[model samples]
Target chain A: MVLELARPRPIWQIMFSTHHTDVGLLYLVFSLLAMFVGGAMAIALRVELFAPGAQLIQDAMTYNRLFTAHGTTMIFLFLLPSAAAVGNYLVPIMVRYKDMAYPKLNAIAFWMIPPAAALVWLGMADFGWYANPPYSVISAPAPAAEMWIFGLKVLGVSSILSSINFVVTILKCKHPDLSLGKVPLLAWSFLTSSIIVLAAMPTFAAALLMLLTDRLGVSGFFNPAVGGDPIAYQHLFWFTFHPEVYVLVIPAIGMMYEIIPRFSRRPIFSHSSGVAAFIILALVSFASWAHHMFATGMSFTEKTVFMVGTLAAVPASAMHVFNFLATMWNGRIKFATPMMFAVGGIALFFAAGAGGVVNTAMPLDFITHDSYWVVGHFHLFVFGTIAFGTIGFVYYLFPYITGRMYNEKWGVVHFILAFVGACITFFTQHILGLFGMPRRIYDYPEIDAWISMNQLVSVGAMIILVGMVIFLGNMIYSMAKGKPANLEDPFGLGGKYYYPFAQRNPQHGEGGY
Target chain B: MAHSNWAEWIYLGVVTALLIYVGAEAWNVERIIDHAPADAEIIIVTGQQWFWTFEHEDGTKEVGELHLKKDHAYKFEVTSIDVNHDFNIPEFVVLMDAIPGRINTVWFSPNEAGEFEIQCREYCGLIHYNMRAKLYVEDV
Candidate 1:
């Protein structure tokens, strides 16, 4: 008697189900949507600042809400989730595990994001993403700030759960033969970043709770009028967020460790050093939080210690950069789309690192504090480095994930436009900041000397908008009609075989257990 | 992967030395605040949401602008009435937070006799962008 094979579930059921890859795909899709939402807000802000006479947004409340939403949506919804998305897709595969240790927990983590994001947009918090209080507590509209705080708390909880899953999965769920020492560098980075998330994110959650109580009039944790020290709030916030910068960048750096070697046709220059860099960055980042509080009244010794901490993290980053350049030294150097962005990311990281050093010098911080220079410095890291790495990975793995290849020429064009546009937008802001322009201001007087530079910044924003449109178009078209990846090792690196397609049944090998 | 390379050690050594140098320079720079003379002009600066109020020791109160004598050291005791703000004079390179219920001091001697910009470096509220004041370093 011939028995009919069990019918597989439909695509819709699978996508909505608790399967790890599908949940990861949902994370990617959600983050992509978040990027557009945040990007649109950014465009509106640039338009209003174009000639500085309140062009698009006339009301101060509207302008405040726009910038606040832009920052919150980007950091919380796009940047963090996108990093998690890459981790979700790659970590289990790299560790040779069938799925994350808790697939249902992963689904819950992804599901928490959408409603939290919705709550943020619904309220449109006007306090800056930093949400410095008593402004966030006493002055800014209550509904919006409270909603933002609630949203952040939920997101933080989701992050903690996700990090736990990652840590446990990496430590305990690897293939039997693979030793901890043999875990790939990308997996090591995820492990390190997850550990950081576990350690650092709870502090933010506690701070958010404190903020909620302060706003609710239940406690004066940050209200100076009631014997609370506002500086304590800054201490708490920066404590979590300073390490957060590493949380944002390290995974992207991990993706670089993966792509740079493959495209350069070399094994990673030094795997041990790369792993050391990740661990070192995590440790040094915690002590460097006070660098953000330089303007706050801290003792000279405190400032010096924080400055040392900030600078101490630099060596690890430098080692990573040195290793990357050395790996690409005299190699085949294929400029695939992924390769272009990886190389660009490392190159831009050098510039960002320089800006960071300048920011670290206690005396120099006086000049660049709260100025467009600081804005430019971070954008170099965020837009130029982190975003570059993430996009490159998407390109590198698109074929593997979708069984379709992205158009190579369009990918190159996308990178060029984004690079030029980002330079025009953020590089000028450094000059403008040096010229004494402060950040978070919605408008400036028309007769100010910054008129021309602001105009240039707006023009650059436009260019970025165009690039983004092309990117979105390219992604959608390619997903639907791009060529099938008929061959393994499509870039022809002749390197070790490490894509996830090897023996899809992950539990039991066809040849051996 | 476990084998340590000499190059890595050398790289770490150079970075450590450079960091120590920068840290030392930073320590020396802290003297900018310490070296203030006892007789320097004192300005008690109070910041609110959208404006700066400079209260000079000589009983002159100025709003939105400060007029100072060039090449004279000025001691600024900055505080905030409502929220956290940073009293920053970009040209003279002075920045310190103006926190409510607390006063922070920073000293700078303006060498350039020109109109410089003073701004609140910390994010306050909606009108934070417009929280600017002019610094006029007139001839002594």
Candidate 2:
């Protein structure tokens, strides 16, 4: 029973979507499409990386293009949009609002994504994804690279619009029952993540525009040997990149908030503490962007502080982890695959976090900075951690959104295979990295014993791919043939934390502001 | 089901696995002196493009085969003087980079490191792949 907002006549209708639910779903569909594209790119990368001197991926230039596409697509398309989708859906529900205060902007924000995705990646097959066009194939004049940055500009603008809408809605429209103190944990995470996006997206706008201008011969803003340092580009790029990661992770934290409370059968443990930690991490995450520049000759003092700040993240991350654990310490346990993946996610994320610390150390970072170790580290956290967290969240939310129950058995199977395969594929990469394999390299030799490891990684990648296929099969199968949801608590946890918007709570509406 | 509590058990498993992995890698490398003798003279001056520099105790400058006294642990704070380049020798398994404006000091006492080949890694320019020098270790 979707009700269109009939507020302030036609003016408000032009403000936001008629309904935020569809807006949320809109984000979900768009990001899911992106995830598929991003995942395909990952497989292509692994295919090319299977062996040294292997023509499986064409050649050096092609390999570089593949990686750049993969990274850009995964980051810009998959991770960011996934977070936005999760936030769009969950934020309103958590804040006790039926819809964003302005539905018109919500509609606009979401529609902006598809064009950007298509232009940046799908269209880039011709121009190449590299900034330096004619990178791989000679005379293969591809303008895809140009489209990539420009499309990103469009996406950035869209993000800014949505962020403003979410923020205003949260500030003005939360239910009176939900105090800042009483606000659901997921809502707090969303609030912080929205702030992150708002703060960081513009810098990316600046950098991309600079790159675009340079490409067009307007001016080489990034061109060095003319007083422009190449390292500055690295600095600026990571400035956006690092906080951008936090934006992606915050929604995962929100999902964890929803998942943990259900299983624990209790109020969140120390909600205020969790909020404080989020704030600290948000600010600290900004300074640590230079950790990406450890190889770029910044000073010892500079490196020392960044390294210290980088490692200091463990305690903060641990605080949240401990709080989540304590919430469930004495609670009734459910082995639902969603919970399992979320649980596995936190654990595996520690691996990436630990590796992050390794790269944070001045000396260690010097060697491992650009190595495959770093790649493995990020994938472990971002994929094993955040991406896995998303899968779990969506699995739990699937019933609510689709009005059906997935085959739990296959979901579990998919979870284990994908998780195990991801570990096998990525962990071996750390070893290859330590053995002096720089990232984005096309070939590795047989005699170096790297052949076995790369093979294992590729094999693991295939396993994960198969697992993804299985999960997709289950999704289609269940959405079509599965038992219908009882129009009730599909999570079977009753309406303790999650209250459907259809059941309106009166009197407690936007009292604070 | 609650994942937070379950996640602790997961954390326990990762810690055990991490310890095992870290221990194994530690066993393999042991120390800087493991590969070469403590008494052998060696310096790891990581090569960089356009120009070359060293960081030995005697201030590595005067070119033409960096001479070092034998039977001493002479190490160089090897680093890149310019762009990303490495010090590679086919005879020795020790090749470290001199990343621009950064110093990655590697130390090794050459057991038989008499005249080792010091080559630049990537093709930094037209002169890359051919850039090489000889390391002269003295008998003392």
Best by DockQ: 1
Runs off by more than 4 Å, candidate 2? A1-18, A123-142, A494-497, A501-513, B1-140
Please provide, for model 2 over A290-334, each residue's C-alpha lDDT reduced to its tens digit, 9 standing for 90 to 100.
Answer: 887654446556765665566555555765777777777777767
Q: Predict model 1's lDDT versus the native.
A: 0.85
Compute the lDDT of residue B47 as modeled in candidate 2: 59
Provide the lDDT at A490 for model 2.
63
lDDT, candidate 1, A305-409, per-residue tens: 898889989999999998898788768989999999999899889889988988899888788988899989998998899989988987886776665678888
C-alpha lDDT (0 to 100) for residue B28 of candidate 2: 41
DockQ, candidate 1, comes to 0.71
All candidates: interface RMSD: 1.4, 8.3
Worst 10 residues of 1 chain A by lDDT: A1-10
**What are the candidates' individual DockQ scores?**
0.71, 0.10
